[model samples]
Target: MSDWIILSTALAGFDHAATKHKVLATRDYLARPEMFRGARPNIINLSRSYAYQSRGYYASLLAAARGQRVIPSVETIIDLSARKLYENAIPELEDALNKGLRGAEGEPLPSRLRVFFGTCIDPRLERFGRLLFDWFRAPVLELTLKQGDWVSISKVALLPFSKLDEKGRETLFQAMARYTARQWKDAKSRAPARYSFATLVDANEALPPSSIDSLKHWARIAARMGVSVEPITRKDLPRLANFDALFIRETTSISNHTYRFARRAQQEGMPVIDDPVSMIRCTNKVYLDELMASNGIPVPDTVMLIGPEDFQRAADQLGFPMVLKVPDSSFSRGVKKVASMAELKALASAWLHDSEVLIAQKFMPTSFDWRIGVLGGKPLFAVQYLMAKKHWQIVQHDTGGKPLEGGFKSFSLAQVPPLVLDTGLRAACSIGDGLYGVDLKETNDGVFVIEVNDNPNLEHGVEDAAEKDEVWTRLTNWFIERIAT
Candidate 1:
């Protein structure tokens, strides 16, 4: 049987012509289901009268319905179709490349390719049909397209095109083509290697339960990637010298135990998931803002206040409905939105009784924000954090405003906009931290960076359990790969 025939049999049950066409179109993509599992299927509701002629298109339709990532063989067709690859495709491709291609040994090429295809196909092609339509106008174009860009095409591809000269375009295209071919070749040639790691969760009084939960989830993921995870509490820090690497999971302050642990890990020359510098970054929001702004990253308009008088002056300059946040607090703790100068003064006065420094930032009215998790300087997952009913902060609840019970919804990394990912990557690189979380607020003008946390929580079931599992698994595998090399 032909390859198409075999593929068709693999998707035997669908009878719709459009469905069949989709299946065929997405044939190459079905190799990676985990990458496109969230994609919606394409199903046409045409009357039976129009059925027969569309039969030939059934394969493509089926592929679409099954969330396949079909790529046309010819560059012209791809350009003309303007079908952007699925948002998860590039990351999945990157992940596969990082895992199976780069530094891998003795792995079967075809098997790796099949795995890539199976895990990365998106069934929802029609959602991106408009992109294809636009691309049809320009049948050929050269641009760096990441996986996240495919999910939200308008955010990435629809922007103003660079007016590159012919030579520049050719040079860029050649570079991209070479890189793509090299990645593919590498992916097919390598074998997955495994290693071991250790994590230290400081269960200090101020530590939240989420931190422990994150450690547990990571431990399981480490096990899956053939890395033995030894989760030691704060008391076990002295004995952690035997481990290959050390990850500190706690809310770290400049002079906190977590910070000391990071320092020790750095002293040992270990590949800490979050290094000492990251801990310092996470502890001070002023530092985060400075770094982000210097790097041309998008963040809320913020002014640091060293004292109560400084806060009042900054608040006046920033205007009302501003946010007053402590330099070192997470899960929305010590973050408050003040409406007027008097209220701000009252709040600041109360907070000043406990802390010496604060930040007055322009508050974006949107209650929905995005929390993107970046592992190894790449985005792992993103989730929409919705404020509780009638609340502004994500974790605000009724009893002293604890974390909201049902306000947030998690999305795969593929669901985030490319701009968000770009901003996130920039933030990650600025901190040079391997694992961190970037909180973003989408204002009318553009997205703003709320803050970045070095030891961001990775609770197992907080968002989508399955996606979180995949993130942990992939992260562990990545750690092993890096350690082996």
Candidate 2:
């Protein structure tokens, strides 16, 4: 069986009809889900009918669920189609759009900040938009926010070049030839050591990939180890089946594409970092509290703040200057430092509006929090994250609400205090062995687990400062081992 197939509205439109790769109608591909699943072919769907509930869309989703490498994986296609999903995106997608339109004041808009919508928008803007989509994984579409309302002027259901002139079409095929040549080699020449893996990352992520420089470094190392690694964004969800394993560098959230990708990748039998179970177990503070408590892991005094009356009991139990957190807070986004009953009441009330209950924990103050990196049930590296200057947490938001982060010092695994490492490993055990960042607070009394993170920051310089390329090489080798076995 061929390794790759193209599912399009019509094969006649494409210039590469003479190529060995199979080109079939989208319906034909949909009709043979079992065949595609058995063959496990990589698919690129060029159907114009990929809107929500469309046959083409569900077929791709079904194929993905059955372990076929279908490009624009159903999850990504659905996410891109739904503009409302980005309404509450981290780093704010809407804010990104606004920033693109209004470059630095008094300076000409950077050439990189362009927007595209078919041929209606300028070519430069189209280039800029494509760059943003490719580089940052920023959600790019025919969207314009006017008067606080989202207005989508167009939909990109099919390849944009369907209407291209003969010359333009030939140019498109030339690009296709180059891409196919690489993919063809990858398909036929994939030795056991040369496993393909896709690392899901976003440019506009809360912790951008560059902050850790993880993607570039990992890809380079993966190549050296006879593995091919691709940096994927939300746009590449459908292409997931092409890889042996998935490493999600993006932050994991339950209500986002990250969760969907984890779930889909798991369903497809791909060994995924931040697996769906890990995401579910790690994202919610409530879950962590129960898991740690049940497993006898040492954690700060914690209780769930359920109602108006429980709030007072929480204060009485944990006392004043407590930490009130939403059940599913991340990177200190929905956490509140309450020093008094009045503050607790107001903050907890506002937080309850978004969640069914809140989490109240005893305030554990320390100069720096310990982050122990655990991969495959073992400690990889350790770091001490100091609180932001004059702030109670590692991240402090400024007047405009952007984050001001604190300094960090990386340490070798052996350098980590034994208790901190042991506690982090114990807490992580309950969640299974994937890449986890276990947050620990070493107090005067004892060390306690703050939380275990599924998609912990693997920032290049900060986490890898001590070991440098060895960090990525070790991580890449983990995936290579998984694929080989």
Candidate 3:
């Protein structure tokens, strides 16, 4: 429910699945993944041991592969297994331990505190237990405490399922009831999605590439296919390994967390949209311009400026009314139309300080620019992005940097001009086989690729208007296919 859940379906066998949640053996879960395919099952692995590659470990691991939700997740079990793996959390956990120890009459602090779903036998330690469970979401945790001026969590590890006592059993159920109870809370369904995807969006972003409602709509379509979609933020980077795939909804930049997130997901071997390679290539206008030109793709007459020396040549070649661009510009921000040599020289002087290279190209004015949505090397949707009223770009920025956008008209792929579709596909393919919005200018001169966007805008009613829900369905299917493969 919050921004981060450093937090699925398929369950495996448990010698001790005493709670109401469903349980299946690890071997059975691995062998019969299809049985719970559409059920979107939530698995609580109660295996006897969770050692490396143990049945418990395999159960959680395999459940994740099939897009089922399981706890303690594979990442949870692994991170909690070793001291070095979770060493950084020790200091924070220690603080929570002391916070619980304060205002205590006490029967003397126990060296070991047993926590069941954030519940504890010692009522004083309940606050510590909840915080511990929040950090590490295993059902049962054993905290090895060290007492001095304050009690500290010296060592914390899983209390093996094989050693649960009768009282421990009671504690587990009570804590679970409190955790899972639907009463007096938001009544929501746990209809297990067939698969799970994490779409990264920045909470504080003023203008995100995909709106929250758009992601929810995609999530809904993904749900119908038994794929669970959850939105995650930067804080959830460590949680990437648990999902089947990842989709980035944030406006991406090469130096930002979005790029790091893309890299992390790819390193985890998950199907990640807006992959890092796409980000690098798409973010630099210099690279993209050269790439399109080298590939024999049609582009505007363009020149690159490394410094002032190339200014006159660029002006002479492209003339006035040229577009000056910083290499890493996006959403039409670092792009400007210079009407005279004075404007070009003034803007280039200021912009070239940060960037080593600037792109100078002929300004081709059109009422609208064509955008083709390409995923997996194919066209998904096409739209005519009408220029902002009395503005030269699809998006115009105010003094406060708020974006004023123009209207759009979505068209079926078949309705798109053949040259436009061909050029769009070529430009997108040159980047990578990932989701992209290829921007092209169609004029009597021909359809010329303006640029390709790694994280394209997938607005709800706008991009999906022509294809209806099929636009989202195709996106979901792309991820599902990649994950399945």
TM-score for all models, in order of appearance: 0.55, 0.60, 0.60
Give candidate 3's whole-model lDDT: 0.76
The lDDT of model 2 is 0.66
Question: Which tens-of-lDDT digit does each residue in 464-483 have in candidate 3?
Answer: 88988988998999988887
lDDT of each residue in 1-485, candidate 2, tens digit only: 34767666666665456446777776565444345434667665656555544445544554544455665554455445543432223234444444444433343333222222112133323444443343222112334333333312222223333444576455544544444565422212111322478888787766552443657777877798888877888988767777788888787876778877776676556778988768766877766776676567888998666557777788889998999887667888788889999998888888766564578999998989999888888887789999999999998865376788899999987887788889998888777888888999998889999989998888778888876787788788787777667
lDDT values, one for every candidate: 0.53, 0.66, 0.76
lDDT measured at residue 424 in model 3 versus the true structure, 0 to 100: 95
User: What is the number of backbone collisions in each predicted candidate, taken in the order shown?
Assistant: 46, 7, 16
Candidate 3's error at 169, in angstroms?
A: 67
Superior candidate under lDDT, 2 versus 3 = 3
Q: Rank the candidates by TM-score, best first.
A: 3, 2, 1
Deviation (Å) of 61 in candidate 3: 37
| Backbone steric clashes in candidate 2, count | 7
Candidate 1 C-alpha RMSD relative to the actual structure: 21.5
- Once fitted onto the true fold, the runs of candidate 1 whose alpha carbons sit more than 4 angstroms away are 1-195, 202-217, 307-312, 350-356, 397-406, 463-468
